[model samples]
Target chain A: MPGGPVNDFLDQVETCVPALRRYARALTRNADLADDLVQDCLERAIARRGLFRPTGSVRAWLFTILLNIYRNSRRAAGRRGETVNLDSVAEPASPAPQPGHIALAELARAIDALPIEQKEVVLLIALEGLPYAEAATILSIPLGTLMSRLGRARSALRLATGVTAEPHLRTVK
Target chain B: MSAVTHDDLMAYADGQLDPGRVGAVEAHLAANPDAASEIALMRRQSDALHALFDPVAAEPVPARLRARRIAAAQRQRRGRSWSWAVAALVLLSLGVGGGWFARPLFEAPAASAVLIADAINAHTVFVAENRHAVEVGRDDSAHLASWLSNRLDTTLGLPDLSAQGFALVGGRLLPGEPQLGGRAAQLMYEDAAGARITIYVTAALPDRQPAAQLASLDGAEAFYWANARITCTVVGTLPAERMQAVSQAVYGQLTDGDVSAPRYRS
Candidate 1:
């Protein structure tokens, strides 16, 4: 059977699933809910495949859909007064923090405390490693606004993790 | 070298600065210890974020999040719904044979014609089956009525057709024309002789003008009527008098409270 265009569209979407999951995990800080969000995003993308423009990248389009769904769910959860499960935040086993290393657990908590908008910017650029232009498009914000948010997010994170002051290193002559 | 701004330092730290500007930013960082320290801290912050969430990307993706699987499931769902109309069309063609001849007693309005065709198609497709005739069986008539009423966004009580020798066989919600409120409810009734009839209903048309038409389509009799509240089509292959009796009964019960309903005439 000739799967053709549909198969190609699905293949492209499949490639972006990992990053979508990663971004969602960082945003929600809960693995199960993060996967649920990804699943919802993928289903919507597949359903509205016709609406997707050929010019935009699939990954960026998927991120836009994922963010819209995330915002909607957050709004609904807010109305229900839902409590987030902090324990669900995946804390990978890491070596003890060195003098300059930000403690992983502390950083995760700091991320949880960041405003939703800033957290999104941080994860898209820092965690997913998307280019500033792509991340800005995904967030539907101008490049200048994205930079400012990233700056504010970095400052908040630095203060939250007590990494605002850097270690003084000897300068090489 | 131009003065190194905060945005420049941030871009350099995030590894996003233009390639040509990188050299200038490095020179500024070398001359300014404080700026250098700030850039290091920003890089570390990015590192720390990756450390926290990168594992989520590296981990094996769950099957549910697989795009192809989701697409396949959605296609199946869409196909199932579309199958109703396709199956109806096929059966309608078989029942009508070559006689695409449809004689209308009155000028069949375009909206009423489509509704009548859909009603007869639904009736032709489901009436032949011994089981799986209705989605919500007659056993749950109360729930069926309320559910169909809620779906159609109007107060839809199950019309009493028992007096006409046909018992309620229950109803199922069907997707309807987008212009006609985009939803339809099909209520099926069966007589002692195993003859089946279906009443298709939808919210009122945009115009909400009252209309009534009787049409012989695809060898089935269809009585269609619309009021301010709703538009209904009753379809069956029963004899002329029996079909008229059943349609009149359904029309009376369904449009009982709607003052705008025009009187149903044979």
Candidate 2:
């Protein structure tokens, strides 16, 4: 019953579940599947707690496991002939676009359409708000590669949302 | 000041630029409206992306995804699998132990039943005794061999099992079933690891039938065979393969010229 360290590990994992779920939802655009992915990631992290290195933060490690599971499942799904479940695709409920904000629904689709590699980098940094270094480490990409992917993703998103012209700002009374 | 690069502009938009370079990038943005607007679009895209997904995090987590629950489920699964492993081992040993004890009842001829039982019993009783494992120690092997040969009324040469890592540990006489022979000689051998094996020898049964049989009795393997000259059972609690090796060697040497004796297998 050496439960102290294991309990601490589970507590740390519990704190990261929300972020994992969010990242997974953004990546898959399917709420149920995203939570399933998060569950799988958490189970794997718990099972292989011994293999976890102490040098990296638990958040980064969890992210790494989540992304790996996500990619592997995608690959398996691809091999099985991708099943696009229309019911499972979560359509973002967005409000009417404000002056400074781009269309959130359009942005969601744009993010989905980006190459998976670029999509991962964009979501890790922009959605998760992880530090550049940590996102780079989690993605196992060089900082330069991360930045370039971010640049490509932003440009792609901007193009997809048709945000080419600056909107005129009306001064409020 | 180093002129801002595209990467620097992107990093600045992302608010990831070094603090020292932030002032320089701000000054560059003030003088450069197009660069400023491009940075603005990147920020808007980031904002839109977050707006699209951040609510997912705010939703209450489902019970199935709880970390403690998952850990508990995994522990339960591991415990069940371990119990299955232990249960399998118990069943396996039961199967082997049952087979080891039930062999004589099913396979052995009535004559071999008594002899193999006697051989294994003698082996178990003597091998455990460190000081008195052999009545006549190997130092008196010549006298012991001849004395047992006279008592059993057969010229019994002590089978050399050194190739299989067992050496002579001398022998003694034991009273045996009168139907087979009134007396038997038990020649003991010991390996470097102190594992002992005994060869139980008796003059041929009344029938003088040439026969060969193997049985696992009481956790010991007894390889029994008879030729015209005598009946010999090599007994040991060694592993099956090692016991087979020692048994094969003894069978080959003891039944050398007895052409009627069948060769041992396993």
Candidate 1, residue B4: the lDDT equals 73
lDDT of each: 0.77, 0.76
iRMS, model 1 (angstroms):
8.7
Q: What is the TM-score of chain A alone in each candidate?
A: 0.90, 0.87
TM-score, chain A, candidate 2: 0.87
Q: Per-residue lDDT tens digits of candidate 1, residues A75-162?
A: 9999989677788865658786666778888888999899999999988888888899999999989999999999899989888777
Who wins the lDDT comparison?
A: 1
Residue pairs of candidate 1 with colliding backbone atoms: none
How would you class the docking of model 2? acceptable
RMSD of 2: 24.3
lDDT of 2 at B187: 90
For B46-164, candidate 2 gives per-residue lDDT tens digits of: 78777777788888777568675565455434543343343234324323233333222333245655676577666766877888877898898889888887888778888999999
Across residues B197-238, which tens digit of lDDT does each residue of candidate 1 receive? 899998887767666656554366677777778889888878
Give the per-residue lDDT of model 2 (tens digit) for A38-74: 9899889988999988788999999999999999999
